[model samples]
Target: MKLAYIVALAAGLAAVAPASAETLLRIGYPGTGLDDRPFGYGDYIAIGHVKQLVEAEFKDQPDVKVTWTFFRGAGPALNESLAAGQLDFAAGLGDLPAIVGRSRGLATEFLASAGSHDPLYLAVPPNSSIHSVEDLRDHKVAQFRGTNLQIATDRVLEAHGLSEKNIRFVSLDSNAATAALVSGNVDASFGGSEYLDLAKHGVVKIIYSTKNDNPTLGRNSGLYVTADFEKAHPDYTAKVVEAFVKAAHFGADEANRQDVFEIWAKSGLPAESFATDFKDERLAHRLSPVVDDYIVARYKDQAERAKAYGLIKKDVDIDSWFNTKYLKQALTDQKLEHYWPTFDAKGQKLTDGEVEQTRAATN
Candidate 1:
């Protein structure tokens, strides 16, 4: 009779336990600031981190602890952590590294588009003679290899009737590349908005940039979760997406434009740089978290480019890798399905009527 009572009590405890109860959640970002600064840049994920959205989301669950890891080696280093099962989720994962990881048998799912249309620039020494992409040929050029920036740089070079073979390519991360450009160690450096600060300080000249240029030339990154983690704790995954989507809403609001910039500035870039980078652009469009047609098409294109550029050996199937059910549910739960506009494959905004149709279809 005593044994029976103990068994009944044990079963009752098990029944009351939360199905998705986790002791800890580990989140990672590919790029860290100088000296491995805890914060990072380039996406809503960074803004969310600064705002402690994920922490607040799990505040009620005292047992659930959230920790973030910022990788100084950038995307490639972040990929290493994910492969070793050291990380559960990756925020602001670049397209190229994610594609390469997927092709190389990293079991992960693309959760949501973290950032898109982030402009690229080519910075030369303050008094350098190089003024065009064509001039970059036969000159030393530096970029972070195995990153989304690499692919964008390749496309830009190809557009100018050149390729990596046509120039001296030096593989360096953003900080190193910026230092090289400023010290004239590299003839030019190609990177994202962070370079604008250098130009503002009269240290570098921005001869070419994707700003107001081809929208397709812009780089893309996204939130990604390892398959093992998602399979084990689906509820935790949903809660994370919901929190990040909330961050997206905060970032997309025009009223919070300056506030959003301030949050991003924590990554070591000045707030004025973000303001200048996003000038004359719609916050909602730039900060939208939805994985709509344009994002899918861009990833698909990125995969193709990766394969063609010899960056990956195997082909990555976009449909199989992209899991957006959580994002849709998050949108519906947050009543934000109609808040952010969806774009077509060519980066054109869909009409309001078409937006409704897209939401219904996803539903």
Candidate 2:
């Protein structure tokens, strides 16, 4: 009877092995220290809480384990990790990496926006008189290549009839670029809402918003997954989306405003000014698994623009480039049923209770 029981247990274990064998939650995000400190390399993993959230969602499931890696900045570290197969999914990718990844057969898939809620803006030194992309010609510019921010930068330049050759492009990371601009190393750099912190300190000011150039700049900064782990363990990808959706909601809270500041502050981020004035749902959530129709149309249009402007290998169908299947599935399974309602950035409000209520209702 004991032998029979052992054999039955062996059969049960075998049944579980296959599913568990291919499961790993290898998420990638900006590198930072624990408690959200920056200089993520050799120290902390940015967006680490996503791991905690995913684990909580599958706490009792023995087959799942989470491992997160950080790319020092969005451009180099993120791109390298994905290229090396050390990363299964990552965020902070620019249009170049996404386009180059597909061109180079990197087996990557565009996932969703980092905020899907909103995007960063083009910024310059607070004291600088420059106000438009057209003004940057013959001046030095700082950027981290392979970032979506670069896409924004390019678009801003193109609108003003400028190209890479028209300006001096200096490669620099976010922190480095910010420091460079402050010290006058470069005339200007692409700024996000994060730049508000420096602007408050009187070091920088937004020259223009990417929103001023294209509304879909929101699609420029986003999260994406590699084809390997995504195909091998699709369910795990779904779990990742669910976790981000949760974080996005959590980030929307006015109560978490301080906590959010602390998170970035820990990472040496300067979100203080932005957070201080950030009182809108626009920056809070972009919970859509479906591409906006305008953005969908622009997929191909942007590719053509990239090619015409000499930014990509060739014009590729943007629809073919995106893979939102997991996001759609995650939204369905998590029972998330609403798209982020459009908000007026100019006249936004935040009710803490409303934030909690909406978060609870959605997630």
Give the candidate number with the greatest lDDT: 1
Q: Relative to the true structure, how large is the alpha-carbon lDDT of every model? A: 0.87, 0.60
Query: lDDT tens digits, residues 3-42, model 2?
Result: 9999999999988777545356676765443333433311
Which candidate number would show the highest TM-score if scored against the true structure? Answer: 1
Model 1 alpha-carbon drift over 4 Å, by segment: 1-22, 352-363
What is the Å distance of residue 299 in model 1 from its true position? 0.8
Clashing pairs for predicted structure model 1, backbone only: none
TM-score of each: 0.90, 0.75
Worst 10 residues of 1 by lDDT: 351-360
Stretches off by above 4 angstroms in model 2 are 1-23, 30-51, 211-214, 217-219, 252-261, 276-281, 284-290, 342-363
